[model samples]
Target: RPVCHTKPQPGNRESVGCLYSCAQCSLGGVLIAMDTAPWALDEKPEHEEVCEFRPYTCPCPGATCKWHGSLEAVMPHLMHAHKSITTLQGEDIVFLATDINLPGAVDWVMMQSCFSHHFMLVLEKQEKYEGHQQFFAVVLLIGTRKQAENFAYRLELNGNRRRLTWEATPRSIHDGVAAAILNSDCLVFDTSIAHLFADNGNLGINVTISMC
Candidate 1:
């Protein structure tokens, strides 16, 4: 028999069922956890709206760019402190990233502002084996993680017969361009396609961004 220094209170019936018995103290003599009501196991609260898992709506102002993110990251993301691409926000605006005639591997980063928010876009020239060349293009969001999911980017390569196009949910610039390219979210093509789209030394594309 073990000597007991403490015991469960009468009101705490939940602790009375403990297995150990103490000979010296009646209160501590028998103590064990009582079984919880079966219904307690079935009580599940809805968590879709819980803060940790909930999507954060971005506080960025303006119309064209719709952004969302986690509440914890809302401020830093809107501050636009990171550096990787130039940010631009506007409507029906066209800007050049690089000169098409420039040879070798060249990467160009630009930010476009349209409908009031900034988006990151990139143009990379890849020199292939045997002197062949390829160009890659992509659009990215500068807002939050949740914002990245709601928006879309469309790149149009205008040609005489047909137009080449690539569209995807833009990645957050926070992910870095290398990561986005590795995921193959950007448009890629060779010099032949470039030749068709290239006008003079400048290659131009019509970018259409939207939220869905």
Candidate 2:
């Protein structure tokens, strides 16, 4: 089926490409994107079935975040919904990583903007390798990794006279959690050891993001 060229859907904007932009879309919903060049019906089918109607969502900061879909979707939601969030213009931030009490899987999320870039950081909880609890923290650059070519940040858990930290380049939002975990680019810790750093459910961290 041909992509929709008639009009942008309700709650959507007319973008340059065939991509439909809608606010209600999770992770900013982008309609099926057709090739920029004319696609011929006689073109050979690819090696696999392509589901044009399939929906996709990008991860947002925190579990309660309803924003998802394409970048377009995020803009409006950010503008209208998060009016109180001031866009900071600095290189360093201190984030309080909390939620030590709730178990069986959870996530704490926060959004930070610096150096003209937006980032979504998620500290996720999971059970891996035979039900052993693990906490993973990663930062995703809103745009492609290329957009943040020289961007870097460090994640740290500082408390109880001890500190655990990891530093790396922030991945693109397109990079899912599983891939980061598999690549070992995230900050991971055992839930059992969480007590060492967590002070009454909150863990403090110093985040320093730089653009070189």
Candidate 3:
């Protein structure tokens, strides 16, 4: 909630209350915490959940991004800072990752706009413990968790008469894609399988998102 300046009318002693401002949001929006008995701010849940002006971190692929700001400013920041990422307009598309056998940790990211919302498709390759490499692919909606629940996504890899598919609901950007990769809660496979799907050093994974 935000705080707005108010004045008490004559003979209205009970209407008087102290006003407190909240400085949690980066946009410097005024949060009015009234001193009224029925408006106990402490009794409420965390403001981050209900605050429309809450801060959002950049969902850019790597750990190099250090930018964070209001929700309205995220798209512009991404457009400026991550211009290389491909942007697609359809709900079903193919994400091609070149050099699928690239050594060491690598990540590929793309933005998809559909259903009047934006989603990010991420594919990450990393070396697991014991010196084996694995790939983690996930889709994240650039919106709230409740909004993400209305949609489902699927990732499919096909080649050599073999197909690997993983279907599930898209995760919200509030829950970073990295968490899913760390938890292995996405489409995961080893280098051997990835090679099977690769054609001339390029792996094209089909991604489809649909309303639930």
For candidate 3, write residues 167-211 as lDDT tens digits.
999987767777888788899999889989999989999999999
For model 1, state the Cα shift of residue 30 in Å.
35
Pick the lDDT winner: 3
Error of 1 at 197 (Å): 0.7
TM-score of 1: 0.56
Q: Between the candidate structures 1 and 3, which one is better when assessed by TM-score?
A: 3
Candidate 1's C-alpha runs over 4 A off are 1-91, 127-132
Which whole-number lDDT from 0 to 100 does residue 84 have in model 2? 45
TM-score to native of every candidate shown: 0.56, 0.64, 0.75
Per-candidate clashes, comma-separated: 17, 10, 3
lDDT of 2 by residue, 1-82 (tens): 2334445355443333443333332324355544433233125222112222222244553435555566546645765776
Q: Model 2's lDDT to the true fold?
A: 0.63
Q: Is candidate 1 or candidate 2 better by lDDT?
A: 2
Better of 1 and 3 by lDDT: 3
